[model samples]
Target: MKVYKGIGVSPGIAIGKVYVYSHKYVNARPEKISSVKAELKKFEAALKTSKRQIKKLSAKISRHLKKEDSKIIAIQMHFLEDEVFVEKVTRAINGGKSAVESVREVLQEYEEMLLKSEDEYFKDRSLDIKDVGYRIISNILGIKNELEFIDKDVILVANDLTPSDTALLDKSKVLGIVTDSGGLTSHTAILARALGIPAIIGLKDFSLNVREGDEVIIDSENATVILNPDDTTKAYYLGKKQEYEDRKKEILALKDIKAITRDGVSVTIDANIGAPEEVTKAIEYGAEGIGLFRTEFLYINRFELPSEEEQFEAYSYVVKAMKGKPVVIRTFDIGGDKDFPYLGLKKESNPYLGMRGLRFSLANIPMFITQLKAILRASAYGPVSILFPMVSDVKEVIKSKDILQQVKDELIQERRDFDKDVKIGIMIEVPSTALTVENFIGIADFFSIGTNDLTQYTLAVDRSNENVADYYIPLHPSVIKLIGMVQEVAKKNGKKLSLCGELAAFKEGIPVLLKQGIRVYSMSPASIPEVKKYIREITLEGKNIPDGFHQGEVDGGL
Candidate 1:
């Protein structure tokens, strides 16, 4: 009957036994070796074996994932090729330590160095170092790693999951993912969503109390996990699970149908995707367009910045695949949880309010130019729009448009074909921006409300923190008021407005947004069918939500 609350990144229900995955690295005892050459040879052989294992794992990933998507596994390959890392291990071995002991010691030093750094890039890279280090040690010790031991259906619990660890997950066997350390925007969360698995994260110390084979119930909709539920509770949740599945099937069957209300008001239903692989699911879910294509995925989880050609290829793939459905490609919204080392950006104490979104793009013109050129070039394939994220000022929009014009001029000089009429938009996630929506209507072509950040900044809460997840209400009166203001301005100006945040697909909030005159909605692909079904039932022809909602309600359900 013990209940633990967490944030659900993916939506679903799972009733299964717990499989606590250990994050312990192999412990190699300090041992003196007489032959330094033999020890070095053994270490080299282990490194080679580790590389082969990574290659094999990458191949397995490639079968189901695109080559670019599979590149996450290459992080390990780069580590294996690091001459300095190899030299450190060799020096330790030459100092009378065994191959296993030397490898373990050197890896610990490297991990400590990264962990001590203030920069988040180095801190995140420590995970990659740990992933590759574990593989190498496992090869030397001739033992199976934790991932290789997932042999049955279970709720996989861990302290955290690395990018490589998540990429190798066998979705059929891993029923759901529960982690002690992770946020809504973590790599594990992103991978779980992409794999369509039920996930609950930031359950601080939840993994410590669970044992293998413990009965677990994960209700992702409410972000709840029950450990060893009572008979009555189990039965209740079992029935709920069945009802959810039945309802899901019923809604999913109407995927291809238009998202029109019973009163005949039609609204665009788009999807917000993080990667190219998700485009398939978006199309399958009957998305009218791509409301938010998070381009930051191209930069993160890699060692270096993505070249313009790479960016262009990725944007082009999605544009061409949509076959003319409008795609709004958001420029790199890097900062906060997604900082890259190559960018050389300073680490700030408060990243959410720091240089992020359009601010980051403006600071680095070359990088900004590269991305704009890619998005513009991709527009030639189909209808494309460039979206600037986290915009708080009208000047940011004007400056972004100015840079866009510069890129278009460069393209013209280079004789490259692109859509000259490609639309430029800004995300009104900041409260100040929403308050001054009229000022931006003249500069930006369109607007999309990123309710996630808007709620976070407006309410002075970090939505990613599970401690305050209770207080991070999306339907708060202030947030809704901001939405209404933006919608009113956009409507008066005859500019297209969309909501591309989690609130867009919220069942209760949909009616409120409709009342605000927001006609376009974008959310995760899995939510589209259910949201569309909910929309179909609503006959909002001169209807209003409850009086409290219209008159500044606080916490009660809409």
Candidate 2:
């Protein structure tokens, strides 16, 4: 047996045949169409074919995955049917361009539009249009390409894989994945992690060096790849694989088990989800509830805000799918480093400090109320919680609660069925919130520390900026003190609190949080098992709690 090593992204072991997705475009000779009318006819036919292919793929996705996972496909179908896009394509083709050239020209224009966008979500979605366009052109040309899945078990290597490509992969036969392009936040990386397949992305020249059906062993923990291994290395990896499988089996047995520590301490293991389709995957990963449901996705990617009924339908579907699990829906937190062209939010000089989170919601009160009403209406179906983001003071908290009450009152006066008693909470992210925790103690139902922003705000470092990314550390003395203070205030007020930041999933941060008296930890479902294992191993009985009162304890908190 031979072993090849690559960077491990997701953590799991599989032995499968290699499946290579070649999305290479073949340059074709320019076609000769006599007139604009003929070119228009060809364009129309291509559009029809694209629509049919989109619908077929969408149906296949709906059958294989949840609606949320299939939402992008549905959106692609809408794009194909969009009047503006159709008109653009028609005009281009009628201007005496070949069918493929017209489609390519239209796609280039759309891609430029997306690139000019300030929103990362919309910017990343530019690839979707390109993918769909490529599919249309390939299908029209009668290309008979096949995925190169090797007959023997091997790791799948690619430049960058898409969700559709990953879906086509036989999970039973693939070992792991290695890619030369992709980031941690990309959909491809997210899906691979969710599927429990070890993946390593961002390796330059990985595709050039790795050949088809090459035996490989990936150590994801250290992000290392070995190529053409010897007998001893193969033996070592085989033993490690068996040990990993055994541990996974043990964790699977705890799927339905509560995440209670040996000392009778129970912590809620919830999932931080973006779209409604993620609800099913959350449940499958043993998430007890939806801790953080970012609702801004509903307002994004369109020319206008979603109607109240549209928001209600989407929120209601997610709540119903959860059955009775607590779903905490956060109001729109946009306009900070993130932007929407349709909202007319101009590019800011310093977006992180500008209008965002609760500030943005308060500015758009009607938009906020619309979302609040939808959450209230959905609460009737199951347990729902409302959370406000980027709050720094009691005034913002009170104002938001008042607006929520106004919506409830309006619904009540109109004799509408809405839940008035939905729990209200605040995301403890600002430095002032951390310093004046007492002011919000009794007013808020729960406090969820968004360490991502809190760390940035406290250390005066922008996490997204690579130059200062290292300075945006959660282990910084100031950041640790703020978290400890938040926990102390929550405990003093006899209120429940949880940490719903990326730090909550960090092994180092989890121990610190447990010592600082944080009992609830909310994270991505994929991180649950390893986090649980870390929590289970720590003995807190004799551990000294890091008190934020003195600078020494504050320093120790880090």
Query: Best candidate, lDDT-wise?
Result: 1
Q: After superposition, how far is residue 486 of candidate 1 from its true place, in Å?
A: 1.4
Which stretches of candidate 1 lie above 4 Å from their native place? 23-32, 66-69, 113-125, 146-153, 160-174, 185-196, 541-558
Give TM-scores for every candidate, taking all chains together and pairing residue i with residue i: 0.90, 0.86
Candidate 2 local lDDT, residue 281: 65
Model 2 lDDT tens row, 1-558: 433333345765443334454576647654777787877776677678768866766665566554555566766777778899888877877777776787788888888887787555566677677766776666545553344344445578777775556655565556688777655544555567655678777676677776666566676765666666677877887887787778677765666667665666777778787778777767877888888888876665466888888888888888999988889998888876557778888677788788999999999888888888888888889999999999977999888988988999988987878667889899988999889988987689998888888888888887656567568788787889988988888898888788877787765576677778888877766566555654555567736332211010000001
Report each candidate's C-alpha RMSD, comma-separated, in the order given: 4.2, 5.5
> What are the clashing pairs of model 1?
none
lDDT of candidate 1 over 1-558, digit per residue (tens) = 699988777778899999888756544453467699988888899999988888887777666564555666787788799999899999988888888887778888878976776544456567767788777777776767677667899899998887767877889999999999765545676578667788898798998999999999998878899999999999999998897778777877988888787788898899887788779878998888899999987876676888999999999999999999999999999886566766778979988889988898899999999999999999999999989998988788888888899999999999999999999898898999999989987788999998988998899997656568688989999999999988888888999999977688676788878878888998877778777777777778546333211111011110
Candidate 1 minimal-lDDT segment of 10 residues: 549-558
